[model samples]
Target chain A: MKELDPLLHSQLRLAIVSLLLTVEEADFVWLKEKTEATSGNLSVQLDKLSEAGYISVRKEIVGKKPRTTCSLTPKGRDALNEYVRTLKEYLHI
Target chain B: MKTDELTEKESIELISRMIEKTRNEMNGDDFNSFLAYGYAAVAISIAVWLLTHFTGNDMWCFGWFAMFIPYLLSFFKKGKPEVVTYMDRMMDSVWKVIGSMFGISLLIIVVAGAISGIIDFSMMMPLSIIYAGIGTSITGLIINEKWFVWTPLAGLAAAIWMLTCGWTGGSYDNSWNLLFAASFLIYMVLPAHIVRHKISRS
Candidate 1:
């Protein structure tokens, strides 16, 4: 049996990647609002995905506040596609 | 969502729901932009219609210049790329293309009308309405909005009817302007309200 990609196996990480897939990029606040995740928790998960090369995180100063934006990397997109393809097999849909 | 371990089915469901959420939030200000343009179109068209009616002058036709104001405001009002979704970008591209095509067509009609003398300033009114319909139809297709697709057809039909009837009603000069106003009302204003309602509900 093929196993799910470990990086995307977690719920929050998966949701983050899914959300980022639909948009060009997303800010920390926007992702936090969409996933309804605590700031600290979302930050940690985002870091894990960043380390896994699933997403790129950019930190910059914007209008007197530090802002973080996340975007799906090409590797991350492929992983997502493969993950979905595997899931379809498991679900037999 | 609980960041705990998820089953295959649970993970799939989560992904699906999150994607839906993203789509809903994509065009956050589109409805507002639509409403602004809708009201502007109706207002400017009506004012010009009345002006032409009273003064017997086609110079009021320049009022169409006001239509681009709403579009300019919309461009400035757009959210940053980090916040704008792929769908929003697609919608923006669609409108940009439509606007460009309309502008080119308008220039052609105006210059041609001036040279030929057969196509006057007043004739441009109905033609513009028909072009508006074409734009609406294209927008509808891009957004998968069925009503938008059909709405423009009605405008085109009315414009054609007015043209063929040769201003069947009272003032022939003002008839096209009235048609333009009516199309803006039915297509733009009414759709704007419906979009507002949907946005509110969502």
Candidate 2:
């Protein structure tokens, strides 16, 4: 059996990536709320994904507040699809 | 959901749950803008019709100027979430195109009527009603809302009724305005309120 992508195998990181798949983009607050993750923890996972080139994060000022928007990169999409494919294969379904 | 290692079934389940949750969030929007515009459109149409009837002056058509209130109010509102989904962007684009079509069509009809000196300005109402039906129906289709789909049909029927009455009675201004008012109320306002109520409940 082939090994899973360790970077995407974690629960929170996988959930974040999964959520991004359905939308054009999501802000930090939305991600935090949906994942029910603490701001600090979500920030850390986002950074790790950013470093791995799985997602792109943009910081901009909307009104007076700094807004952080995250989108799933093409690489990230391909990884997710491939992960699902491999997992399906493992399950023999 | 934090886990050191997920089995194959668990991974599939997690992915499915995440996708489902995200989709629900994307669709979970209150129809604030729709409700505002629907109510305003209904009110303006009826008010203009009543003023025209009571005053016996054609100038009451200018009451349509009030319809801009709800349209412009939408811009000043800040309820839009920072995050937008694919469906959100698509719905926004749909409404924008529909709005532009109405603006351009109205401008063309008015300009043609004025320059040719042969077209009746009152004729614009039926055409506008038809366009409203088309727009509402298209929106209904895009959103998968059957109520919206039927609204356009009802609007078109009202427009047809207005045309028939004008042909038979020689003057159908009141009927035209009344039908439009009813259409806006039934297809736009009522459905918007129902959708908003459902959104709140969900």
What fraction of the true interface does each of the listed models get right, in terms of native contacts kept? 0.78, 0.65
State which docking tier applies to candidate 1: medium
State the DockQ, from 0 to 1, for candidate 1. Answer: 0.61
Give the per-residue lDDT digits (tens) of candidate 1, residues A9-78: 8889999999999888889999999889999999999999999999999999876778898999999999
**Which has the greatest lDDT?**
2
Q: What tens-digit string does per-residue lDDT give for candidate 2 at B150-188?
A: 877787887787777678876646646677878888888
- Score residue B133 of candidate 2 by CA lDDT: 69
- The digit string of per-residue lDDT tens for model 1 on B50-120 reads 89889999788888788879877766663454566776777677777767877787788778988888545
Query: A1-93, model 2: which lDDT tens digit per residue?
Result: 877788888888998999999988999999988888889889999999999999999998877889899999999999999898889789888
Note the Cα lDDT for every prediction shown. Answer: 0.79, 0.80
TM-score of each: 0.76, 0.86
* Candidate 1 backbone collisions, by pair: none
Q: What is the lDDT of residue A23 in candidate 1?
A: 89
